[model samples]
Target chain A: MNIALFGKLIQLLIKEKMAYRGDFLLSAFAQIVSYGGEYIVIWLFMKRFPLLAGWTWPEIALLYSFGLLTYAIGASFSFVQMRELEGQVRQGTFDNLLIKPINPYFYLISRGFNLAYVAHITISGAVLIWAIGQLNVQWTLLNWAYVLLAVVSGAMIQAGLLTAIGAATFLWVRAGFLFTIFFRLKEFISYPLPLFGTFIQLLLTIGVPLAFVNFYPAAFLLAHDSAPLPGWAMWLAPLVGPLVYGLGYLLWTSGANKYQGAGG
Target chain B: MDSFELHRYVYKLPVNAFREQLRFCMDLLSVGEFAHKPVRQLSLGQRMRVEIAMALLHEPRILFLDEPTIGLDVMAKDQIRQFLRAVNRKKPTASPGRNLPGRSLPRASLPGALPDERRYGVTTYMMFAVKSFTNQLAYRSEVWLRLLGNLLAILIQVEIWRAVIGSSGQEGASLDQMITYSILNPLLLALLSTNVSEAVDSSLKSGSIATELIRPLSYPLYLLAGSLGLSLYKLAFTVAPAFALAGLLFGVLPPASPMNLLAFVAALLIAMLMSFLLGYLVSLLAFWLMSHFALSWMLGGLITIFSGSFLPLWFYSSGWAAVAEALPFQYLGYVPAAVYLGTMTDEAMWRTLAIGLIWAAALLLLVRWLWSRAVRRLIIQGG
Candidate 1:
């Protein structure tokens, strides 16, 4: 929670990355290429069969842009710890964090920063903007406020999901494939959620709460008649973020207590 | 550009093993502790046998034996030396030009005499890793099945293209047809190649490469042989069966001419070589970057997209398609697919082939440059 610690971590990360110029640029370019190519598959799919499940091109763009915006925010911030948790637990380095004066969770999350990963955010933003222009939704101040809320809350929900999954690693030590399952589901989620079979749609909406991040918020913004979720559920989309994050924190704290710090 | 050369590079079991054996030759070393355990895990001598057994995995043609016995007691070193000599003499040598130099050493001298075919100018070489009839039988069946599968995929792709285009037309279908033709090929290739390459590339970076590199042959050559061995297995077992299924599911037609068949074969070979070389060059970047997975993932994705594998470059705007043709990606998939469908003329085929050759040459040079630099770094690091 200390502002100084966050500032110090950012400065250290920039300095460490600057020392390795080749890796920095290459890694950035690689991220750009990887994200660009994956989205291109969706683009081509849309181009081939436009208006997927009654969703137009701009609606699809919104899904991608908001989804990615949240992903980047989570990944570049709180969920950084999730990526490293497996290695930290297996190596028994969690004890060092526990002994520190500041919050162990804060230090753990702030330790790694993928500066190169912002390329994804940038590309996704560009695509989103282009799609928004084409869609040309009439935006009032209230609409703008909702859009802002969606962006921030969407990021929280995404990060919270990852944090919760990552915390599970402390309980289930060898959860290697869990990450892959989340990744595949995320890719599937980037598309319209309704195209899925009934069971899958219910699972995604209720179990994973993927709909709250992009699809629901997008349906609100477009104010289109065909949104799958009832009008009342649109209001609930933004709340999902804080709710999940609160639950994730509780789970993470419990998991932290169980750590025997064997590697330490 | 040539598939044969690509085969040489990817299916390099002979060379990779040889290099490892040669390094051990100058100084035979072994440790008995299970890997990932510390060096102190076993008696010093038991470890040497593990080293010898490990070296045997490559089935090296020329093994260098250094002061292998120096660290060991007399009895231990003798047993180790005898093991080395036995492997050296029994190992089979792949074809010379098909192999990188220093790796294609002659089959063993005394214990297993070099086959008579060297006299007839057709070198009789054994596939060094196994010798038992049962093993050979199992391997041949596996290879046959793989080839069958690949052939089946190729046939299915052709039938799909034909259905989209229809018969009796003066020309093959347009860009749509080409894209349809190439859609499944790269996906299958990606599924097969990417994970395996990642595993090997990571192992090479993490010092296990030391075990592979110290053999009689070059490391790259050994990997090439292994890939070819796998590809052969795939072609027999996978491609042929795929062809049969395509024939049954969608009635098949003979190629318009033998020339069409030749062009298809040529294009595939070129594509495979280009893909393998490009893969190797990217893998060598691991020496500079701690992790090459991102690079591999990015490159593999590009090859799938821009290579006209998933979608034809033709579907792209004229400017974009022109840009794609200039790159090596199209030469890997689209060019051959088009030529095989009889959509491309002879002039176009030659042009594509020429572009492919140039790309292959550039990639090979890049690989050599990176490998030399990496080797020097290895020497300095004293790994």
Candidate 2:
């Protein structure tokens, strides 16, 4: 409703943060180093072993890269879910947006920006580039396009998970720690989801659909040598992110209706 | 937009302090050393003002000020209070700019105002008595209660461990042997982790250190005393009940000997001291850093993982084990547990003790230097 107010908010953020150039760079650098180090550790392990539960190096790379991209986008844009909803609720600041003209969810999701998270993109990109060099896959134009689409959709799916958790806060006030459990579960996405046995794979495919963000795409890109999944599943992988996000949005709206306004 | 309303939402309050938030508020209103100085260099009072200012940076709709005036002169307190009042009144008059989640006003009753009437049933009185026993016993009591508490918590834990070991079909490992090893192992591990700065540092920020600092008592002794108090309370209310419930619900084993008990207590005391000092140094870092939360959190994670509280560091690759051994992280929780479990050697115990001392001295010096620097900065800045 007030685009000017939104611009003013952005301006305030930029203006306030501009003075802390050293801090900003230091924070972002630290995040990149720590997360990059973690990724390298995992990657190095995979390289030594060559394959994990039958998934090859490049395929693993795709999964890892896509997961990082989705996570990075989510971290860069809407990572406040990392703190969970309890803080805002406990602080009694959850209603600050309720008095505003715009949707409270938008403001809540974007409120605390962690620019450091974008550093993950750099780390993931390096991993992808290195993996691509090692692999012998012919990159088609459509494959590249699908890759871009997959990244975008993966971001949506990741955001959708967080958004759903954010929405669920209206019902379960203590759902803040539950978000931590979700993030911890994301560690499973770093590998081929199917390797974990049927029950977990089923849960990831349908329940969380996190597998679509990484494993499926990686399987298709690397071909059948490493990945057991069919090529058609690769196309389906890209769709799952958006479909999950749409479903999450539907749930979000339903939950939003329960919000009792700032004064309530 | 009321400061009081904001405070209600953000802080839990029995409002205990060496000097409470009100003192800081009162100081800001007065004309004195604090009034003339910039907040950063004005002693603890001025430091508090700077802290409040920092907290207000994001223009928090609801802000919690914990013990805002712990060591401030009266004049400084008045100014802070006046500043808070002005901020509260003027905040909503201007542009509310960003649309955060909540209104400035709190929606529910303040935590302290609600009466806690739910009783823990028949054991409630016993628990209450256990908690208050130290307070009732008055003279030179810090050491007595502190040692007693540490002794008791370790004993209980060892007893539980012994019971577990006995049932697990490990022969020649008497309840006493198991208790001794369990206590020593955990103590060593706890000591090791105390060597790291993170856990020790954050605990200090809880404002638990101020009472110890202002008192004539040495920092370690005071910490030991407080920890002892906590341990005693934990033993009665936490360990006893936990064991009781565990035993009643499912069968349990008890530890074998009093010597194992003594060794465990000794190691645990050292570990507790190490933990407190570690946190003390970390909190001291706040004087230098904007907020030590992220750094502390990261450090805590590394320590926890390396220390092998989740799983034994021995189970990690030999390389990781070397890394863990090289640092004090393993001493935090794992060593003491391991010692009590009879896993660590006498040589390792001595090494842990020596490392604990080195860490303590290093941290003590660091804290003193940091404190001096912070005080100087506060004096120069006058905030």
TM-scores of the models, in the order given: 0.64, 0.57
- Interface RMSD of each candidate, angstroms, one decimal: 7.1, 11.4
Candidate 2 residue-wise lDDT, B1-383, digit = tens: 12232233223223443124444433443423444353334556555655565345435466655446546666765667667776666566433222122323332223321223332232323333333344434323333433333333344344333333455534434455444444444334323332224423544455433322322223333333444555555455434554454444334344324444554566566666656566656555655665554455445556555655533454455677688777766656666555555455667765666776676667668776776675455335422
What are the DockQ scores of the candidates, in order?
A: 0.18, 0.05
lDDT of 2 by residue, A1-264 (tens): 456665666677777767887666655565565565455444444444455656666667767887987878865555574355666665567667577677766666556655556567877887878887888888899888887888888887887887777777677665655565566557677766545546656767778878777777777777653234456877887787778778777777687678664232
Provide C-alpha RMSD values for all models, in order. Answer: 10.7, 14.8
Q: What tens digits encode model 1's per-residue C-alpha lDDT throughout B126-156?
A: 2321121222344463444344444434433
- Could you give candidate 2's fraction of true interface contacts? 0.00
A140-233 per-residue lDDT for model 1 (tens digits): 8987888888888887787788878877888877555556556656765676666555665676678887778887888777765424568777
lDDT of 1 at A106: 77
Q: What is the TM-score of chain B alone in each candidate?
A: 0.59, 0.45
For model 1 chain B, the run of ten residues with the poorest summed lDDT: B116-125
Residue B188 in model 1: shift from native, Å? 2.3
